[model samples]
Target: MIESHNTKGLIFNVQYYSIHDGPGIRTTVFMKGCPLKCLWCQNPESQRLQREIFFELEKCTGCGICVQACSEGAIELFEGRSRTNRKKCSGTGRCAEVCPVEARKIMGRSVTAKEVFEEVARDALFYQRSGGGVTLSGGEPLAQPRFAVSVLKLCKDAGIHTTVDTCGYASWDTVQQVLSYADLVLYDFKHIDPAEHKRYTGVSNELILDNARKIYHELAIPMLARVPIIPTYNDSADNIKATTQFISSELGKNIKVHLLPYHRLGETKYERLEKMDLAVLIEPPAEEQMLALQEIVQSFGLEAVLGG
Candidate 1:
């Protein structure tokens, strides 16, 4: 039992009433920081551990309020547009505070486990009625093991079903810590091939696959394999077949596979975070393509569902 409710962790969002994350309407707590740098990451702002500024160019009116608010002089008008010198800016959120149109915003916040749990518990009535609970999502929940454990433990103590959504890139010990409290695990299976996985997510799938096996065979936890069907990446029939076969042979046939179709929803987030949208040109998988992949997954005698 985690006795400390004061352990601080960085989190970006607390989304309530989310149906896709777990069994029912869930409140997904998006933790800050991630080890994997996937090309098609939906939460680019969640990549960094510390608080960062989000400057929406279209929302800025070039009124120079943020310029005067920033003590570091990080903000300067460049042709009637506010530009930030990220190196000079310390993410103090002073500029974001004074932005009239809400163009400038800070991405993440530091909060205690108790504080987060209190907010999560606010939606207990909704969770009870819908058979939903709280989900710990990324950046990668296991990246901050202690904080994740604290939050999960708090939810579990309160009788809220806990789920950990992870990339399966963390250590076995970290996975064990989270699993101690998590009722379910949503593990991301990016690609079957390690080389391709590394090429895309900047990490090998060797540890991920190994962790999946450990979690399934050793821990015997309720697990769901979530595969994001990218158009030109991991959507091929060969990769899909390999993924299903691995689950059937290594992990068990009872595990359900969620076939998630990749979308450009996070593309605009890159603009706000001042990062490049690497997969901007990539289109979402067609409906027919997703259905075909579902067929391949079901062919392995595994239940496959489209979207979370």
Candidate 2:
């Protein structure tokens, strides 16, 4: 039945030697389709629910191979150039199939739990040496909760240290299932204020906060709360204080809060995906801004650290 229905997780990449995700030298499996759309998202290509193809216009070399490969006549060539009619195209990856230069990328691919585990466990020697295993990152892994849980359990059963990097925008059931097997949970705490969060990330944070508290109390797992320090969204001195206060008092020592500076890598993805450019609205926060923010939050008698 599983093979008949083609049930599989859509993964973008399996990154090796990743140090920032969890403990030392981990393999990060980036699953696609996120529930939230934060403006400053570093991995915008992972947002869509379905597979997407990115065409690098500069690398095209005006090649018409993709135009000829389309069976639906979805691709068009004009003025010595190739263009995909967004309305006519289905994003079925025909264009990507013929682009030999790797300029065309199908953003997501369906892979079985066994396939993913094999790739992850290939780095078993590295994991054993460095105390790292696999970290499941977004889009949002819980968006495909069943697949995420299955992979986590397989890793844990194999005696591999497992970490789940999530936005915490999933249902309590989904969160609980994955947490049942995860060793460390890197939870993203975007914003505290619901209205502000909605304005920035296109989602409310009520459930996110509730889930975080549940993880602290019910799950009681070792977790690190990450706050992306976007200017005008959640970087105010007052907001950081409020966030750290709640994290320290309510969440306990099992959790620590780290604030990250906003970045612009997602802007190019915005252009590629024909989405709006949010980078123009704000700049990356200054170093002094980070120090001040850290000081204010640490003054709350918490062990707040930087650099993940």
Per-residue CA lDDT of candidate 1, range 1-308, in tens? 35379989999999998999989999999999999998888888888788899888998889998999999988899989898887888889998899999998898999999999999999999989989999999899988889999999999999999999999998888888778889999999999999999999999999999999999888888999899998787899999999999999999999899999998888888888776635355798999999999999999999999998
TM-score of 2: 0.92
Residue-level lDDT tens digits of model 2 in 1-308: 11212347888888999998999789999999998878778788898767777767667666789988887787777776577766676668988877888667778888888788888999999999998899999889888887887788778889899999998997898788878889999989887778988988899989998998998788888888888888877889878887887788878854667778887766677656655544345688999999998887778776667656
Over 4 Å off in model 1, which ranges? Answer: 1-3, 277-279
RMSD, each candidate, Å? Answer: 1.4, 2.5
Model 1 scores worst on lDDT over the 10 consecutive residues at: 273-282
Winning candidate number (TM-score): 1
Quickly count the clashes in candidate 2.
Answer: 0
Best by lDDT: 1
Clashing pairs in 2: none
- Per-candidate clash tally: 0, 0
Question: Against the unseen true structure, what C-alpha lDDT does each candidate score?
Answer: 0.91, 0.81
